[model samples]
Target: MTTFYILVGYLALLMGLGLLSNRFFKGTSADFFVVSRSVGSFLLLMSIFGTTMTGFAIVGSTAKSYTDGVGVYGLMASWSGLMHSAVFFAVGIKLWAVGKRYGYMTQCEYFRDRFESDRLGYVLFPILVLLVIPYLLVGVIAAGKFIQPTTAGLFPEAFPMPNLPNGNPHPLNGGIPPAVGGGVICLIVLFYVFFGGLRGAVWANTFQTIVFMGTGVIAFYMISKNLGGLKAASEAVAASDFGAERLGREGMMSKLQFLSYCFVPLSVGMFPHLFQHWLTAKSAKSFKLTVVAFPLFIMIVWVPCVLIGIWAAGYLGPLDPGQSPNSVLGRMVGQLVHSPVLTGLVGAGVLAAIMSSLDSQFMCLGTMFTNDIVMKKYGADRFTDRQKIWIARGFILFVVGATYLLAIALQDSAHVFDLGVWCFSGFAGLFPLVFASVFWKRVTLPGAYACILSTALAWGYLFYHDILAAKPAGVGDEEMLVFGMMPVAIIIAISTVSLVVVSLLTKKPSEAIIRKFFV
Candidate 1:
């Protein structure tokens, strides 16, 4: 009964936020689609940060830490948070200035106008769907993990997750079953997301970000108290063989991986949805202010989640019997928290983290597919706003469906971190294009095209051989080539330098084009 009330409370809060934002959601497609291009720094900052820190970070990172200690920490992508902020200085602020100056509504709108090539915009659009769908899948899967069972008994018919009849041992021994949980989350997320668009997403994310951050502080405090405080928890981790052993294995590789994780934000600030948020901001000053304040939130909020991961090393044990370490957070709450009401709150907080990102992801995928891929490319200038909205809805369904299928197929796979890193690798290749778009002149259309195609081809080829295909005999998978973001960046830098040299020597973008866009 208590769990029932908590679930109701969480849903009501979400709906209320959406209703509140409805006032601001009025006006043209520009207004409704991207908050009327008047979002202030605080709101803009909160939305961007809120969207990026998904349940994947919370659950997947903690799970990896539980199994492998700080070594697996490389897999968490924490540096992405910092890189995302740095990107604001690099491109986000400038993007905002240009967007407002030109009255651009979407990334594609800006690109099409700047390049004066609908053909290029059309070509560039399909990648939006490819980039965004995999991310939405991660969000959906994580949300499903929390919601399916958190409200399991609240509405038996609505949330019919299975459990043991005897209650002696749990199903999957208290771990979530992927498919059943994943679907429920997708349904709830799709409902609000389809209607809400970017406005709905921003409002919901703002409120949920509060819940997520607040809960992290509270949970960290409670966990520390239960474990005899932070000093004792540190001692426990240092004393535990599991912590030491896992850290040792990860050793240099773990630190290297953590640094590699920075690639997330490196490419993230370039992501279309992020550009949308920048465009929505009231001014460049607001955008800069928001970026400045963002790292504080990351340091305080996210750092605690990592601490909790380490704390769990001492507080929790090897995955209960056959359970995977990834299930550690949920399993620990169920076993150690003791009070059902507190357990419900903790579970809901985790769900908030998951849903915050899910809404943004769905909206990002929907908008990018509709505006960039469908309307701009195929429909050209002939597409109506209503038609675009419908296309967005369709992409939402397709993206969700693909992710649902992936969740089922990859259920047995333990390395979710690898999947996420691989999914975002393509953007690393697009870095030079984005950089040159803002700061560098003499970046020709041919140069941009070469950079995008080269990065995609190289990364795609390597990803397929290493990740998709079965490894050949006697070949170590580690030696099999994980080119990752750094390699992709090197490829782009080389390509861009060569292109600039060529363009300057030959046919540069006309002075008129340079002043209009690049300058």
Candidate 2:
């Protein structure tokens, strides 16, 4: 009853924020799509922070740290936040300057206008859809996982486990009806986002960030207290051979993979939604100033999660067969936290963290698919805002549906942390295209397109081998494949180099195009 009340209160707060912000977001597509380019640095900072430190990672990071030990701390280097900040400082400011100069509303618009190529929009459309859909699935899976167990007790005798062909019980414990936890959360996100648009997303993101961090901090303190303080936890870890042995070579690699996650913020920080957020700044000075604060935000948010992961390791011992450290944080909360009120609040906040990205991610994907992919390819330029809205709505439903199906299909034999790395790898493929588009003046459309295609193929090949193939359980250290951030980094390097070489060898992007984008 206490937990239920706490959850209700959290939802009420979120809905109130959505209702309050909805009025400010009415008007043009830009208003609906990008908050009318009026978001302040504070809003931008919170939005970026919330969206990047999403639910997929917040829970999974603890699990990764639990499984891998202290080595996973290197993953907290805040590469994504750093790179995202740098982009804001360097590339983002410039992108905003040009958007303001050209009255460009979207990244695809920027590409289309700068290159004098409607064809560029065609290329970007599919890329954005592909980039966003799988990523959104991750959030869906995270949310469903979090909510499933929490509310399971509610169903009780009504829940019945399904029988397999071999007569084993269905893997989902007592088979309650499908939770739709992810879908329910998405509907909440859509309610605020549909009416309030980008402003709503920003407002909700700011509030959500505060709630998420506050809850996480409290939960961390409780977790640490229950297990003894951090010093005691450290001593506990030292005493346990689990830290020294199983967490050995492969453990070191997992740490490397964690460190590699830094690139995500770097690459995704420049993503369309982020690019639009950068453009909304009141001034270039504010944009530049905001970068310095993000590193601190990353540290404050991630450190507690990491510490909690370490604590879980000592308390839980080696993860049980078929159990993941990713699940450890929630399980620990379920087992250790005495106060159901705080536990439910913390759980709701975690779900908010997951949905924070789900909303923006789907929105971005919808916009890209509609504006960049579908509209450019087939539709006339004079399409109405209503049409675009409907298209976006349809795409949102599609994205959620696809994610739900994928999560169900992949429920068995997959780890959340590993799935996260795979999704991140897909985005890493975009890093070169983004860099070349913004920085290298000579990077031709063909070169950019080739780089995008090749990087994706290379990334897919790696996933197929490491994830799809029947390799050993811990086969080829986690870092060697999906978790290995460096491999994606290396691919980015190669793709950029290859694009540069190919662009020089081929016809240059028109001189007019170069001057417009560079200027």
Name the top TM-score candidate. Answer: 2
Off by over 4 Å in 2: 157-178, 244-251, 254-264, 373-381, 384-387, 405-419, 472-479, 482-485
- Stretch of 10 with least lDDT, candidate 2: 170-179
CA lDDT of every candidate: 0.67, 0.69
Which pairs of residues clash in candidate 1, taking residues 3 or more apart in a chain or in different chains? none
Candidate 1 — what's its lDDT? 0.67
Model 2 sits at a Cα RMSD from the real structure of 3.6
lDDT of 1 by residue, 1-519 (tens): 676467558877787666666566553556656777778877787788777777755666677666556655434444654666778877888888788788776777777766667777877777765776566666656665565556544444543445667764334333335576677666656666666667888878777788777776776677777778889887887788666454454453534444455554566755777777777787777767666766777666656666677777776645566565656666656665555676667766777888877777777667766666666546646866666666777888887777888876765565444556665666666776777777777777777677667767777776777678877797753423244334444444555665565556655677887788654
lDDT leader: 2
TM-scores of the candidates are 0.86, 0.88
